[model samples]
Target: MGGPAPPAGPGTAGLRAVRGKSIAVLGGGSLGLYLAGRLALAGHRVTVALRPGTPAPSGIVAEGDEQWSAAVEYADIGRLRGPYAQVIVAVKSHDLPPLLPALAALGDGATEYVFLQNGIPWWWRGIAGDGLPRARQVVGVVVQHSAERTAPGRIRVRRTAGDRYLCGRPDGSVDAALESLAADWRHAGIPAETTPALRRQVWTKLMGNATLNPLSAITGATVGELATEPATRAVLLAGMAEIARLAERDGAGVDNTPEQRVARSAEVGGVRTSMLQDRLAGRPLETEALLAAPIAIAEEYGEAVPVLRTLYGCLAFSSTSPERNPT
Candidate 1:
């Protein structure tokens, strides 16, 4: 799934009509609240879907160098009113199974589903086969922002680097709705663009997560700490090199070397990887999707990923052991 990249920049006249549509954002995580708040402030009728008993904030407050807040309606996942124009999924990969069936029940051929999650998405093949009506359009999103939940109903955007978001069709086809959605995001101060090389982009992001996330989780170190320590740095490079080879085998070759990735990590300094953050918060680690899945693919392609396998084992044990304090 690849093609020429789309033109860059904020808005075009054609996409001005994209606002004020009814959109449902699934999940109450920092990213989800940030997105729902931004979309609501952008004039879209935003509805946030949360699990039962999760507090439905009267409004979401986005804090960083500045502050932006917006009131958004909330709905329980099982009680969502149907036929949304677009459904933005911002849940963790591990939490997607139960939500998938509900999403399928609400979406139809014309409804557009946008997925924003770490690691590989389960619906990469196509949402049609996942019990959804064949008419639904699926767009994959690569979110590059660093956001954290500081408190209930509040989120902080810690860092904004490169493009804020990348949207593309999973099947590598162009859709006007996708382009318009990207434009809308751009107009709302979120740097977003449409790309045809969605799979390559996904693998490129995976290169960093597959290495840094688990390593940081295991060592309880920030990216900078991992980069500067000779021992951890060696493990980091070896794991990334394995992922690079796997990417090549999968025909999604990444150009950045492991050292280059480390250099980029250095720029982020004290920021901890998401897995490490989850560990500290006593939340479940996303090892299966972020680490094990890639290793499984590498094995299927007859490639060795010993470092990844080892990291996966360590993370699996750490997350489950009763004696360990993840923090």
Candidate 2:
């Protein structure tokens, strides 16, 4: 309703070009695929760089006249190079380091990165060790598309680019380029907005992710089933409160009450959080960045997060065998 809040501390990058631009998505996940489809459909030439381990379904590659099928490649950045205006890092946050050297190697001086992963931006700067040089060139994106690999390359994607998506600069101002990109992406889904207060967006998503993801995984339940009873919602609220506390102390706000977010979770019925899906499939969860990281930060800020600690323990204990916890 209002203009985005001003940049909090020393990090924020505005979009450079509001006119036509070529972009490459760095991963081949459902997010990348959906983005490719939407961008291409909107008349923007889009390329997705795929690594050997990245999953791709047998979905037909229908782009261009030749219609060459798309599959994963084990090529390095120099080999599978991108000379585009923007390079999007769609990989998991933990898996970011492997590609950073390549992106840094590009060193075009004009290429910007759009971070499509969840969690805090400050955490990202720490992980990559490049700080604001990398941070300022970043466009923080919030995505609400439910995705997973159905097979190798063929992802069974929903028609929406994503249900909720946004891109914002570090200082919280909208560049014409990001606004245009959002408009182009709308052909794929309903993108929420662009703002400078991306911290709020990221934290809102983290609250939902940190709470519901672990709960669902521990109990093997869907979102609706979890919220069906008051007890589960209470546990979730405790987790949310911990995040809210840390976010405020960290100098950011979700800018909404806990009750408002809790209600939104209820609306996404019959869906299991990503952690539940990962645990069931025996894949590693984003535990450090998603659950433990926020709780740990709460401690650093001289606050208590007992409920989060307990929930984190419960999730860690239940989602895996005792052997996994080094006990």
Clashes of each: 2, 13
List the candidate 1 regions with Cα displacement exceeding 4 Å.
1-18, 125-130, 133-136
- C-alpha lDDT (0 to 100) for residue 150 of candidate 1: 74
On residues 10-121, what C-alpha lDDT tens digit does candidate 1 reach at each position?
2222323344988899978887887787677777888999788787777998776437677899987878887887888988899988677677666666678888878877
Candidate 2 lDDT, 33-83, residue by residue in tens? 655544444445556666655544443243221122333233333455555
Output the number of the lDDT-best candidate: 1
Report the error of model 2 at residue 115, Å: 0.8
Least well predicted 10-residue stretch by lDDT in candidate 1 = 1-10
Residue 131, model 1: lDDT of 67
State each model's CA lDDT, in order. 0.77, 0.62
